[model samples]
Target chain A: MSRKRSRNIFIATCITPAIMLFALFMVVPTFEVFRMSLYNWGGLSGNKTFIGFNNFKVLWNDMRFIQSFQNSVLLIVLVAVLTIVVAIFFASVLTKEKVFATNFFRIVFYIPNILSVVIIAGIFSAVYNPRTGLLNSILGLLNLEQLQRQWLGNQDIVIYSLAGALVWQAIGYYMVMYMSGMASIPESYYEAASLEGAGKFKQFSAITLPLIWNNLRTTLTFYIISTINLSFLLVTAMTGGGPDGSTEVFLSYMYSQAYSNSTYGYGMAIGVVVFTFSFVLAAVVSRITKREVLEF
Target chain B: MKETKRINTDTLYKVFIYVALITLAITIIIPVAWVFMASIKENQEFYGNPWALPQGIHFENFREAFVEAGMGDYFLNSIIVTSLALVFLLVLALPAAYVLSRFEFVGSKFINGFIKAGLFINVSYITVPIFLMLLGWDQSLRQIFDSGFFLNNLSVLALIYAVTALPFTIFLLSSYFETLPSDFEEAANIDGAGYFRTMFSIMLPMAKPSIIIVILFNFLLFWNEYILALTLIPGDKKTLPVGLLNLLAADRAAVNYGPMYAGMVIVMLPTLILYIIVQKRLTQGMTVGGVKG
Candidate 1:
């Protein structure tokens, strides 16, 4: 056998199974989601009547769907901005060699990222429990009892509470990303900046910020994508989208529709919208961040 | 004179950094520590003084969590699903990544892109379709297995998890393989070693760091995955997260805060330990994968 033919055979043998599985599980089912969006297929029934774009029309008129989308968008913006700012701040501090107990602080901060969402929600639920929770207790200790209110139960504040929990959970991961990016920056820049008598904040703003712009962009993209797809566990345990559906992100809303309400077709329509939003947002961010590669 | 001035500034910077870090640590630790303390609090104490330290270590809560909540079975079920999924991911992704990274073949780029595209779609977006597919498969299994005993149908769920882990596995392994020098394979080829033997003996062993990262990340993901298990597994075969949710829901009208807290702690320990052990690798791997241009 020729060498080229044998290599082709090897590649074919290796790729076939994965290709088949991908088609069956991922590609086909994605198409199936699109197909189901066009039908009136409640989850349990064999009667799947064709109902063209009607599900999408229903979704457009659905106030809950609109609210869910708005909530998701708000979450994306809040989390993306807060996480980046916090991550960059910590990364800058930690990367300085003189920082004491840097390893200990890193591990402590990263613990939340490692935790399951269920556990995180459980802990935060205790912390924000209004009556006996830590936040209210602290408020009482500070003699601000009148200002203390139910954190998760208050409709106006539930989304902010959820966003706070998410930012706490995620800042560690993004900090690590920023730290890695900072590590890759040449030491000469810092030395030169110091030689030129650049103040700490000036060095950060003028030197480190632009140098790690790529990492910042990547982290922003990921944070946005993840927040948009925020799931049932966080929302359910923390607030159950509570105080009258105030905390319902798109994914949780879609989950409730499909599983809780058995509105499968409408849920599928929401799924399609989620897919488009994520894709377009990612594409735009990727394009915006596509700059000439920095060698250093 | 300049050196002394620089030293003073450096010392000041050190002081500032330590202050910031200590504050961040407190913010992170207090909530987790509160949860731990709350888990061991007696029912009365939990209600009366949720923030205070537990008066006594309530080992009974753990016992109750295991016995009343069926956490033992759920833990085993999770182990079975996560391990099987991890093994399947490694086996499938290893050779596929090797071939894609090393060989130039028709449709290879498209297949690589196909693997990556899975990561783009949120898992929830595909949940309805996956649930429908599994239901269909369960019906077929009943006809084939002929037992009407579908409780431990975690194998099918494991298959789905393997697919979910594939994108990361393939992406990481392929990149790692790309970094491997072709000299070793060439030397093995000169010695008449076949492709499989070369891969098993040379490439696989060399990719140990990548393999560990893949296993740890995939295990963490599959272990805590609640939505899929909730959808796929029958009521009796509940995994830990699902069981915790069920326990929470059982007394929906009343808050049985003790067992719910106990269940959360029990479910969290494995993941917490795994993270501590693999902290460095997990953080580094995520950064590289997430930030690479």
Candidate 2:
């Protein structure tokens, strides 16, 4: 055989399997989500009908979807703000300060990130249990029993409860991300700022912040995407959108509509919205947070 | 006089930092350590103070979790699925990543862009469609075989796990491959090594550090993955996380707490041990490509 022919054949052999599998599993199914949204396909019923955006029209009036939309937005904002502040604080401390046992704290903080969301759900369920929970019991011991309430059982507070778990799991991962960014900042920048009589807070805002602004901006997008995904997973495992659908996020509602309600069409419509929503949100966030990249 | 005030304020600042750091550390450590303590506590002890230590070692919860709650079988299933998925992922990803990054081939750029776009495709949205597609295949196969094949099959589940992981794995591996000096391949070619021979004996071995990172990350991913395992396997064959979810539900309904906590430990222990051993590498691996699912 010719040498060129042999090279072409080798390339084909190497990439064909991965491409085929990617198309079949990842590409086709993703396409199917969009296409199926335009049809009324009832799962397990062996009937699929073309509906032409009627599913989306129905979703417009879906009170449950709207509630889930609100819940998801609340979670996205709460988790992003809380996790970012706490994580950046801890990351700066561990990176800049000569704290004792810095390695121990870094390793311990990341423990929650390594475990399954299911395990986190289980842990928080124990922490949030009303009569026998760690949180309430601690309150009791501190003589602040009036502050204790049904952490997961109260409708007014359950969404916040989910937010807390998400923030807890997320802080370490983003902390480490920021720390890596912080670690890369040249120390000369900080020394110069200190020479100008900059306090710790001033130096952080002026020097440490802008140098890592690109990393911070990138994590803003991550915060949105991961918060959406994790809130669903945690809701699935912990609350199942429970105590009367109080904690239902986007994907959990989509999942219930798909499986529990058996309305595959409606579920796919929800999926399409979420997919577009995330992309748009990320783009808007990235646009708003855009800054001139700094070279150190 | 001014120096004394500055020293006092500096001391106060140091004290404040310590308090904040220790508070965050305790928040994380106490819950995990409490779970370990709770896993060994007797049933009666759980009714008392949540802060109280376990009175004595009670290993029976683990026995119940492993045997009665079926975590033992689920653990074995997880081992099989995770290992199989990793093997499939590396086999498929390494070659594709190798050729795509190193060689100039037709459609390579388009293929690269296509795979890069797959990074935005989260599994949560596509899961139901994949489930339906598998169900459709199973239905077609049932005509001839008188049974189903795609759904509830461990190998098929493993294949899906690997496939879903392709974008990230290939993206990471491709970047690593792009850094290699082409002179190694040039020298190998002059010595009469074919493409496969060079990749297998020369290029792949040099990629060992990255291959380890891929395995470690994906192992945790596949082991802890539950939604796909839950939906795809509607039957008895379940991964560790899905099984633990079931056990949690059942035990919660029955008000059985000890076995539930034990099940949590069972699901998390492997990942924890693995994390502790390779955490430095794992966190460092994050900055390369820096995407999370």
Model 1 lDDT per residue over A1-296, tens place: 77667667777777788777767777777898788888887857646889999999999899998988888888888888888888889988888565666787788888887777777777777778888888888889899999798898888988888988988888888888889889888889889998998988999987888888877777767876777655455896556777788999888888888777877877888888887887788789889877665666
User: In model 1, which runs have C-alpha deviations exceeding 4 angstroms?
Assistant: A1-9, A287-295, B1-16, B140-152, B251-253, B291-293
* Candidate 1: residue pairs that collide: none
* Predicted candidate 1 versus true structure: per-residue lDDT over B1-293, tens digit per residue: 99999899978877877777887888888887776777787878866755677899987877778888798889898889889888878877888988888877777787788888876656667877887776676677778886543334787778778887677778888898999889999999999887778878998999898889888778878888887788777668888988887766663346667777788888888888888887888888886475211
Residue A276, model 2: lDDT of 95
CA shift of B49, model 2, Å: 0.8
Regions of candidate 2 where Cα sits further than 4 Å from its true position: none
CAPRI quality of model 2: high
lDDT at A174, model 1: 82
Count of clashing residue pairs in every prediction: 0, 0
